[model samples]
Target: MKDSFAQLDLTTEGFRLLFEATWIQRPAGLTATATAGEWRAVRTPDELAAWALAWSDGDEDEAALFRPELLADPATTVVAGHDPDGRVLGGAVLSESGTVTGVSNLFAAGDTDPAQVWSGCLGLIASDRPVVGYESGDDLTAALAAGFQETGPLRVWLDA
Candidate 1:
């Protein structure tokens, strides 16, 4: 159900298909100038694949699990940052602990303090598992600032 985008290769058409098929519109506040603070949840595999590639550097397993079809039973929380025109600049999704997770792709400018954004994302996940796959810079800094610590040694899998 994870939309199969990662199963093959990522492309604009594939992304579009995934987005159109899996994206769910929700009420979220957004702004221009690359400040996408508003959030809408994703519920389809294709949407999850697109988001994962864009945000997590094409993490296949992470993206695959987020497929809307697979998350049908649980809450696959999708949050988006949009430009004034409502194009997605970045986003994040919350999955059950063992499901999909990655760094926060906020669209705030460099001057914007990452700690603040970290707090915002933390606020979204109440009574959930520890967030995983953060981008490992400001994102990780923000997570630490917001009271999340590493649960184990860092690990990554690559194709041989």
Candidate 2:
């Protein structure tokens, strides 16, 4: 489970610390230029399925995580970056809350830079509210380079 505030001590409950990440935020109204790939919101179920496939690297079980019902959510948007040949190179899911948009499920494929995906996602969102998310490792580096600032720490635990 996600311990967003890093306040949970799950060890006694039989959970183990899986990983730690940082909360990241980008200021509101920041503009990003389009990158090499074309970015747009996925509108159809077919498109969403395709995006999920790309995101999971063709792993059907993993792709199933993103259901078609997500597309109907008013606050949720699935954005995909496509190359000239129409292949999905990267994507992200944007969910808007009260004052900030949450960016998640960000992924990049062959020859696609994670920074470019973040930029394209920001351009597609184009919202006045700040963007917030969490990341670790290389993704954290990419988000930082794409103009996000570290906000706080977060942790994930697994029932072991």
Candidate 3:
């Protein structure tokens, strides 16, 4: 089944924050304003290693996999969100173009608001394409909230 989803646009203030950031001091190598999660300037191999460790969650000694030069590149984009306790719950990285090239976690498909927010942000960069993606579940209310139309007659199936 196919459904259309709502697109959200940032408020003027949010747009300002999204577009006008200069620098973010990150624990992992320094990132440009375009990149969301980068915290500091990564100048050395040690710094790059530390930054990689800080960004990852589990026991994966994969920091060495990173190219040191990429850590400081401004063209890279990172985005992150924190829980109430200030721990990261979600994040992603994108090239200058808005593509879901990498994601930390799959989106909570039921949460239309967050999905709308993402679409809104995407609208800013990729205006030609439909900013929203597809989501599937038993819950149609969530889809409605995201501006989706019910594709067929609602039916409930039960085990006999």
Candidate 4:
């Protein structure tokens, strides 16, 4: 079954402060067994494909987030995580309220920290709206660390 997920929501401006105040100051080792990484917006189909491929192991549901219909939307914004070697690590997506960062994001895969991923992903999203998404564990921690307070828990049942 799918695990129950927690939603992390906050204003873009609020999150940016977290990014600038805490997240960006952290170290980024992502090379030669380093402890840093980087993120960039996925502007092309190939870029989106690479990002999605890294996150979609065998789950069609996960891959469906990369559908062309989703990608074609101007609101859609996918960000890629890569190590110094340029290997595709993972990705995050933002889109919903035309000005918020709420859609989808798979920020784990490589050695990058969830906070860093969240911070970087926000770089491309519109800053005028609020951000929201379902996350857990380190990702959840990252969101909270970014200054988001819990509204409530989100139960998500998986097909077993």
Q: lDDT (0-100) at residue 152 of candidate 2?
A: 95
lDDT by residue (tens digit), candidate 2, 29-73 = 778866878899999999999999999989999999999999999
- Ordering by lDDT: 2, 4, 1, 3
lDDT for 137 in candidate 4 is 64
TM values, all candidates? 0.45, 0.94, 0.31, 0.63
Which regions of candidate 3 are displaced past 4 Å?
1-57, 63-68, 97-160
Residue 100, candidate 1: alpha-carbon lDDT = 33
Supply the TM-score for candidate 1. 0.45
Residue 100, candidate 3: C-alpha displacement in angstroms: 11
The most accurate candidate by TM-score is 2
Candidate 2, poorest ten consecutive residues by summed lDDT: 28-37
lDDT for residue 38 in candidate 1, whole number 0-100: 54
Kindly list the per-residue Cα lDDT of model 4 for residues 85-159, writing each as its tens digit. 887666677666644457365566656566666656655454455666665566667767654555545544322
Note the Cα lDDT for every prediction shown: 0.45, 0.91, 0.34, 0.56
The runs of at least 3 residues in candidate 1 whose Cα sits more than 4 Å from the true structure, single-residue gaps closed, are 1-36, 43-75, 97-117, 127-135
What does the lDDT read for residue 135 in candidate 1?
Answer: 37
Residues 1-160 of candidate 1 have per-residue lDDT tens digits of: 2332234333533332222111111112321122225545655566556656655555676555555664465645665443465444455555544533444344333344555555445445543333554334555555555555544333222332
Clashes (N, CA, C under 3 Å) per candidate: 5, 0, 11, 8
**Residue 98 deviation, candidate 3, in Å?**
10
Best by lDDT: 2
